[model samples]
Target chain A: EPEVTQTPSHQVTQMGQEVILRCVPISNHLYFYWYRQILGQKVEFLVSFYNNEISEKSEIFDDQFSVERPDGSNFTLKIRSTKLEDSAMYFCASKFNTNTGELFFGEGSRLTVL
Target chain B: AQRVTQPEKLLSVFKGAPVELKCNYSYSGSPELFWYVQYSRQRLQLLLRHISRESIKGFTADLNKGETSFHLKKPFAQEEDSAMYYCALSGQGLTGGGNKLTFGTGTQLKVEL
Candidate 1:
């Protein structure tokens, strides 16, 4: 079965440095999303992307964050300057339709900011 | 704003016992709820959704609009049921935008022998 794939399963970056997390959603999926889970915390929605543009974003997704579908298959989240609080597990999810209300999540990328 | 709450952080039950994972949400409009499970060493996967009204792995969740709850229940739980369960809600109706999901803190279910 096809599944969402994420690169850099684990990343360690320094404060004030930039980091990019990449994801390749299911080929047929139309909607994509990015969520983060702080250690031992609930998963928080960051942004949703459709038609190669962001549809909605949360307050956590501020000016420091940006998402891009650089290609038909690759979706990426970039943080301009990482902070200590940015350490968390980032998940990339995709769905074929809104009606189903089912999201396929990738293995997740663990980002550690020092 | 939409929020999901799972009151129980951890639940333990013996094999063959029934199990119930409580999930409640705070949403004004119509809500689409789902239960996702993460087994040991596995990625998070959709266990069941309220819309389908179908049972997966003998687990079923009923959407209660009156109480704003969508709790997952399973009778005769097996040892394999040990995993982390998360409740999520999607705001996708009128006046609601995007398919973003608000998830609960999750409940760790341990089916002991």
Candidate 2:
């Protein structure tokens, strides 16, 4: 079966530095999302993307966070000036559309900020 | 606001024993609930959804609107059932903008032989 693929399974970066997490969603998926899980905490939705624009974002997804498809096959989440609080496992999910509501998630990108 | 709650963080059972992972949600409007499972070293995957009213791997969950709960149950547990299970809820509002899901803290099931 085709699964969502995430690049750089693990990322280590310094505080105040920037990091980019990339994901290639299922080829035919039209809606994408980014979620973050702080260690020992429930996963929180960051943002949702559709039609090349952001549809909705949580307060946690502030100026520091941005997502872009950049191309047909790649979806990337960029964190500018990361803080220790940004250290978490980021998961990328995609679905054919919101109505079906079946989300396919990637293996996850573990971001560590020192 | 929508919220999902899983009362237990860890549940252990011996093989052949029955297993239940409790999940409760709070939402005023109509809600959709789903169960997702993730085995060690594997990506998260959907287990079942309440809307389908189907059983997968002998596991089933019933949505009780009166109780605001959707608990997953299996008559017999297997060692392979050991995994992290998360309960999620989505408010499928008009236009699908409420497509985002609220997930529980997750329950780790340890099935021993």
Candidate 3:
């Protein structure tokens, strides 16, 4: 099955540094999303992107975060300033359309901020 | 806000026994429900959706609109069925915006011989 692929399976960064997580969603997908799961916590939605614009975001997805689909196949999430609390497993997902509502997810990028 | 609740955090069953994973939701409008599973060292993947009404790998979930629940059940358990299962809910505002998925904490299923 076609899958969402994310690079840099694991990352370690200092607090206050910036980190970029990359993903290549399924070629035909229209909707893309970013979600994070803090250790032992529920998966929380960070943002959604469509048509080169952000559709919605959560309180945790404040000014420090941004998403871009710079090319037809690459989607990225940039964290401007990382904090220790930012450590978590970040997952990228995409959907072909709303009819199925099934979001295909990547293996996840584990982010660790010291 | 839409919320999904999986009351059991852990479930253990002997091989060949029946198993049921419970899920409940709280949503004011029409809700879309789903079951996702994650095996060790594997990525989370969709198991089934309520709308599809299809059974996958002997696992089936029925959406009881009146009860606001979508419970996943399997008549016979196998060791492979031992994995983490999550229930999720999405409501009317799903098209754009965050299209957030409210996921339950998840239940860990263990099938023993």
> Which candidate number would show the highest lDDT if scored against the true structure?
1
- With a 3 Å backbone cut-off (N, CA, C), the pairs that clash in candidate 2 are none
Candidate 1, A2-114: lDDT as tens digits? 99999999999999999999999999988899999999999999999887778888899999999999879999999999999999999999988766647999999999999
User: Which has the better lDDT: candidate 1, or candidate 2?
Assistant: 1
lDDT value, candidate 1, whole model: 0.93
Compared with the true structure, what per-residue lDDT tens digits does model 2 show for residues B1-113? 88999999999999999999999999989988999999998888999999999999999999999999999999999999999999999885335453887899999999998
Show where candidate 3 strays beyond 4 Å. B94-98
Candidate 1 has an interface RMSD (Å) of 2.5
Best-to-worst order by lDDT is 1, 2, 3
Candidate 3 on B1-113: residue-level lDDT in tens? 78889999999999999999999999998888999999998888999999999999899999998999999999999999999999988665445543557789899999999
Task: List TM-score per model, in order.
Answer: 0.97, 0.97, 0.96
TM-score of chain B of 2: 0.95
Question: How well is each residue in A27-100 modelled by candidate 3, as lDDT tens digits?
Answer: 99888889999999888888888888887777899999999998789999999999999999999999877555
**Which is the winner by lDDT between candidate 2 and candidate 3?**
2
Clashing pairs in 3: none
Model 2 per-residue lDDT tens digits across residues A1-109: 9899998899999999999999999999988899989999998989888888888888999999999999899999999999999999999999887875689999999
